[model samples]
Every structure is written in structure tokens, then in C-alpha cells.
Target: MLQLKLYYHAKPYLPWRFRMATRRFFAKRKRIRYSGSWPIDPPSGAVPDDWRGWPNGADFAFVLSHDVETQIGYNKLDELLEVEKQLGFRSVINFIPEGEYSVSERRIQELIERGFEVGVHGLYHDGKLYNNRATFESRAKRINRYLKQWGATGFRSPLMHHRLDWLHSLDIAYDSSTFDTDPFEPQPDGLGTIFPLWVERKIANPESLTANQENQISDRRSAISGGKSKKPNGYVELPYTLPQDSTLFLLLRESSNAIWKEKTAWIARQGGMVFLNTHPDYMDFKGNGNASSFPISYYADFLQHVKESYGGQYWHATPDRVASYFVGCGDR
Candidate 1:
């Protein structure tokens, strides 16, 4: 069936009650297989005991990324940057080149200047980028142009509306548009692994890609061409791990960082990637409320938990650095 990409952003503007009612409707269906909620080793299995930690002997890995969707969010970047910097953390900030926010070269440079990573969020972020083949083909060219202009090698589809086969055409190195366990996204399909994956001609199926669990992630990285040669043209895909604020703190109207803490531990135990996408637009400065209504210091607390629990055990790096680490392993 053709996926009718209704205005994807319309849900956020929905009446509060309607949003809650809809959440009630799909809550159970979304968890049928525990797709986005469960880690690589669900009840049916266990993480391979031979699992190795991240490079540098770090216990696990975490990558923080943000998608700038609105002007308020763009303006909120300074505050977020201050928080991350003050805490000794660096994150990749993705910007929409076109759409409600007009990202200028100056804004791009600001991110670059601050020692942060810059990534390309979809050109328009309108949810229609992949309504069909021709539409994506048309937009893909502009997206590539923006990639070069903005000097971005990472991409996260607007609202996470991704068509992997079509997305492969872009010359980016990695994409964080997929998830390991997320039920609230516009397109909620979990690729079933918590590590970076090679999305290319060789990787034709998700299960086959991860079914060989032993050395699964390392094996996949070895096959990535990263656009260096025509023999196997493809990109690495880093699955976003934690639930977005819109889904957890807003639509579901939860009030705590319990989920973040839980998932962080699971990813660590599995010794997998902990890539997260928390939008600045959805944050709540106040520390109390429906939580879904606001971030309310939830993000900060989550970071603190990571530092306290794992401390030097986890490799806290951006997605680009992780990608490089994987590629570097392959080169060795």
C-alpha cells in the first residue's frame, strides 16, 4: 500500500485531548514486538557475552544529536550549547536548510565555530520528502547540494520519514534517522540493533544484517564503502536510541527521565551505541508538569546519570566520531 504521508507535523498542533486519545489508540499496537522499546537482547535472548566495549576501552558509547525544527528551537540553541559545554559534552546539531527556519551560512558557522558538529536535517522537514519516488528523487538532489554547501556528512530525515533505498543516493557518511525502539515517530520501525549499520547494496535486509549477532556491528562496518569507491557505494546508519521528547514527555504526557535512564543502562549492558535525538523545541525549562509538556531538566538529569553510572566506562562522542571509529577499525 502506498504510504500516504499526511502533513506529518500536523499532529503536534492537535488539540491536547485529541493527541492523548490518539496515543491511547496506538499505544499497545506500537509495542506488539517491543520494536523501539526493547534493546538488542530482548527477553527471547541475551547480549552476546563476548561483546566488546567502544574504542579506547570505554564501557559503551553515546551520541547526542538535536534537530532544530522551529525558530524558538533555533534561538534555544545558545542555552542548550551552554548546558552541554558547561558539562563537558559535545553534540551534533542538525539544521533545516529550508523551511520555517532560514539557516544562513553564519548560523552554520556558529555551530562549527563552537566545536560542535553540524548535520543536515531535511531540506523542508515537511514530512512529504518521501511521499513517493519522484518526490524524493527531486528533493534528494537539493539535499545533496545543501550537504556540500553546509559541509554536512550526516542526515536525519525530517520527522524521521526515511526510505533507506532512496536515501542511499545521498553522499552522506551516516544517518541517525532510524531507531532501535521508538513507537511515537512518524514512521516507527526499529531496525533491531543498537549499533551503527551499513546501508548499502550489500545490506539488503535488516534481520540478515544483525542476525549474525557475533561481531555483528564490526562486521557491518567492514563492508561500508562510505562512497569512496563504486564497488560498494553506501552509508552507515546510526539508530537513534532514546524516545524523543515529543513522544515521551508530550504525546504520552509522561513526567520523568526514567525511560532515558533505563535505555541508557540497557545500551551500556549490551555495549552498543546510545544515540539520542532530543529536540530543543520540545524542552520544558521547568522541572515539573506533564513532563511531556516540558523537558523540565530531564535531559540534564539523564546526562548526569550517564556520567555518574558509567563515567569513564562510556565513550561520550558525537555520531561522526563513532562513525570514524568504526571506519578506523575497518581500516585496521
Candidate 2:
């Protein structure tokens, strides 16, 4: 913890090149160490117990989301939107409320008006939200305020750090801070399932909530089918099932989207959700290698592949609608 504190404290002073190189070194080691589990965790594909299956009998659910952490990323939203639009896809755009960049309500509304859902990323992109109970409680108030102000119903933590029980404080329909499997993250632990789980506010025992996700899911699932008690409400937890864009394009330096395509196919076969979280900050429309950005074509190609390979077989949805459907199904 001390090491992480020092690293984040000094992060502002370190050049991104130095940090990326340092991470790349460690990431490569982790990639080899966890090669069998990451990107494609076989057990994660298991359908949830008593699953009702996707809407309209679709093979799988698909959702795309982006986190804009800087002014540069915010500026590229339009270009990114156009690419997705051209491919007949829509996604959720999550903005940092108090990060290095400033986004106006008008801009957020513009995204909503353009057929995109808006969400609140962490208050700051810094990795401090879960530093301690007090810090999280304090920030939750502010985060909830932003969620209300922006009329957003989703929240994703920065760096994928999460405290599932702590998240119940926020006024949101769903939280996308967890992933199915990613050893590259600051919090290397994963939820171990591709399906979204309901984090019932009253049922989540403090002890289970702090444990690893497998145990957490076990305790929650037993409590799910029962009618929602007069117990306090809870929010849906959508664990992104695909590899993050930065982990693939920047840290691992992958040359193509083959990994994405391969994983998507597997998820489809298992009838699980193909939830993806990408960053516009690292998408290079210019095709220049600046800041280790990858060509936007990599993303566009993946979208095109989805369109061609699985046309009419998947339920393409925004994050909010996914959560709404899950809630309305009374499976919570």
C-alpha cells in the first residue's frame, strides 16, 4: 500500500513514457504468469445459475463503453462517436467529474441527444477513491452529487479499483468497475464471471463483500431469486468481460484486434455478455504512435467484425438499458 501511495503521489512528476515503459516491463511478466487465465478465463464463461438468457433469445448481450480521463480524450469523443455511428453501434461515454479535464453539462447532454448514454467515471482519475473507508465515504457523497447533477445512472472507478459494499452509497443503476479477469490492473483480483450480478444492498454481508468475488457471488446469488425485501435497494454490478483497450494496445503492444475477436467469439458461444470498456484517450485517429496510441482502425475493425460475424445474433445495448432490463426481469 505504501508503494502504491508513493507511486501515485509521484505520478504527476513522472513522464508518461517512463511510466508506460515501467508498466510494460511488469505487464509482460504478468501476462506470461497469468496467460492461461486472463483475456479468456474459461470458467468465467459459465452461465449464471438459473439464468433466464438474453433478451429476445439473443445469443449474448453486447455493450460498449468509454472513459474519458483527459481533455485530449474529451476532444476525441466526436471522432470516436462517428466511427461507432458509421458502424451502426452506440456506447456509453463516462466522464471524470473532477479530473484534469472539464466537461460541460451541454457536452454531456449533447452525447445523450446523439443516442449515447452518459456515465460518471471516478471523481478524479487518480487511484485514491478506495484508499480508506473514510476517504470513500467522503467521496461517495460528491460522486452521488455529480450523478444527480448529470442525471447519469452509472459509475466506473478509475484504475478498476472497487469496494462493492462501499459502492451501494452511490445513486446509480449499475457500476462497471469490476472485470471478468485482468491481472494487469492495480487490483488484480477479478469477479470470475462474465454475467452481471445484483449487489443487493441489504444482503451483502460486510465480511462477504470484502472477500474475493467468487465468495461474494455465492452469497449474493443465494439471496437473488427471493422477492426484493423491504431491505434497502441495491445496484447492478456489470463486470466488463473483454480486455481493456489500453491493456491490449499500449501496455502489451498488440498489433491487431485478433485477441478481441477471439474472445468475443468465445463469449458468444457461452451465451454471456460481451461487455467492453475502451478509452478514447488512447485511440489515435491520426494513426500516429503518439502517447502509444493505437490506430482507430483497430477499434473500427472490431466493430465491423462484430457486425459481419454476428449480425442479428447479439443484443447491442447501452449500459443503462442493460441494467434496467436486468432489474426489470426481477432476477435481482
Candidate 3:
């Protein structure tokens, strides 16, 4: 309601161009300014040698994901998969089961068969998932059923609207709907760290966190920066780094990979996870297009950059794979 009202009634009156320019300008400055914010504390014993690395000693981690919103984006999945495979990258493509187009179970199966991951986006892009407790609980049941049908354990909210407190009701292993920082989302407060942290069960309990994602605990206070947080992992949260393709390319009018490269460098140094969310509907087929057009190669180029710069220093895992690493049956 607030978001729709803002986009409908207020956007026309607001100087959005000025805002985007200011945001784009500060985006870089913040990136530079907060380079120190991450690796949140000085070298500590809790730091793992491969903080970013994964099983068998990979250095850093990257989980590339695509949110399919329209038929155009949905149509591009095969090509996207080919592009990723050619570059040795496998991504998760989320779909709206009964939204946009009738996304069939067969298509999702095809994605899995192609060695790609499939997850839920939302039933509709209408932004009502969190309207009220009853509405959310009702919709969650359908979402959970679809999740089981797809055999998925990951989710990213439609339009990036999320409520961490309500997530325990979601049966996913982890979520990729958050950002280290993004100014364009409906509730745009960024969580500051690129590292994957457990959404502690107590914290996510409905009584613990308000329905408002913008005013949640992590939003109000820094989740990192102390000695190590003793919070237990209920489910994992892999933070997306770099703004989404739509934000940088179309909104901010960027035309290059400079921001991504800078972010990748910082994340690598800090040994943090990079969970990038791109839309299949928004990217292009060529590798050399401007960011304003979101060339297909923009993502490919970033993958290449990761390969060239960090190489084996990072673990290229799926969302479930990363979460599975943290969740294991103890005392087996």
C-alpha cells in the first residue's frame, strides 16, 4: 500500500532524476567509504581461513540468481542457462507459479534437468504478501505447497519486499532476497554485511520481529561489528552484493561493470559471499551492451571477472548448497 502509493502518487511530484543521480553518486562513495565496514572486526580467532571459501577449500563464494517476472524474461531462461554453462556458472531461476503466465511444473523440471536451480518468486507480483497476518499466513500455505512441488529450498520476495520475522513459516533452507545495501528497493535499508549469517530462530519468531522489514532488529542496529555474534543459525541469509541489473542499468543509467568489479574486489578481500540477483527479463544476449540496456554479457563479464580475479579463491555454489554447508545432522 505504501509502496504503491509512493510510486503512483508521489513519484511524479518527486525529483526522481535528482534522487537517482544523488543515489548513483553516493553509491560509489558509500562503496569506498564502507570498504572498512566489512570484515567487520579486526582479525579474530573466529575467522575461518576460507571465510569466503567452501568445501574442499575454495576461496570465496558466488550464487547468481535470476527472478523471472514476465514472459520475456521467462523465455530467456534457456539462453541464460546456456550462457551460464558456457562460462561454468549455474544459477537459480525463480518463477511465479500462477502469476504472469501459468508457469508449468514441466518448465521448472526442465530447469532442474538442465542442471540449474528453480525456486519460488511469488504467487503474484502484487506486493500483498505481507499486507496482514491472516493474508500472509494464508498465502504462505500455497507458497509452501509450490515449494514442495518444485523441491526448492530458496526464496526471494516479489519486488524484494520481505519480513524476516515471518520467514520461519517458510520452509526454505535460505533466502537471497536481501542486499548488503540497495537504495531502490521498496524497503531499501541495506543490511551492511555481504557475509551469510543465520537468521536466528528467536529473532525471526513473529513475536521477536515486527512485520515491518524496514524497522527490524538488523535494520535498526548493526548485526555485525561486535566481537562475534553468538546468534544461532535457524536459516541462512546470503546477502546480494551490487545493485540489481534493473537498478544500475535502467534506473541509474550506468553502462559498465566498474561497480561490480569494485564490489567483487572488496568481497574477495573480506572473504564474504556474493549473492547476485538479476532478472532474466532484463538482461540482453550480447556481452558488450551498455548497463542501461543490461547486456547479457554484463553478467557473463562479471562471472569472467570472478574467474580471472579470484579463480579458485571462491566457491561457486547454489543457494541450497551454501545453506546445506551450514546445516548438518550432528552426532551422526
What TM-score fits each model? 0.82, 0.90, 0.76
Model 2 weakest 10-residue run by lDDT: 222-231
Cα lDDT tens digits for candidate 1, 89-121: 889999888868788888888788887989999
Predicted structure 1, TM vs. truth = 0.82
CA shift at 131, candidate 2, in angstroms? 1.1
Candidate 2 lDDT over residue span 148-187, tens digit each: 7887888999989888988977777789999999999988
Structural RMSD, model 3: 8.2
Better model by TM-score: candidate 1 vs candidate 2: 2
Error of 1 at 81 (Å): 1.5
Best candidate per lDDT, number?
2
**Candidate 3's TM-score:** 0.76
Ranking by lDDT: 2, 1, 3
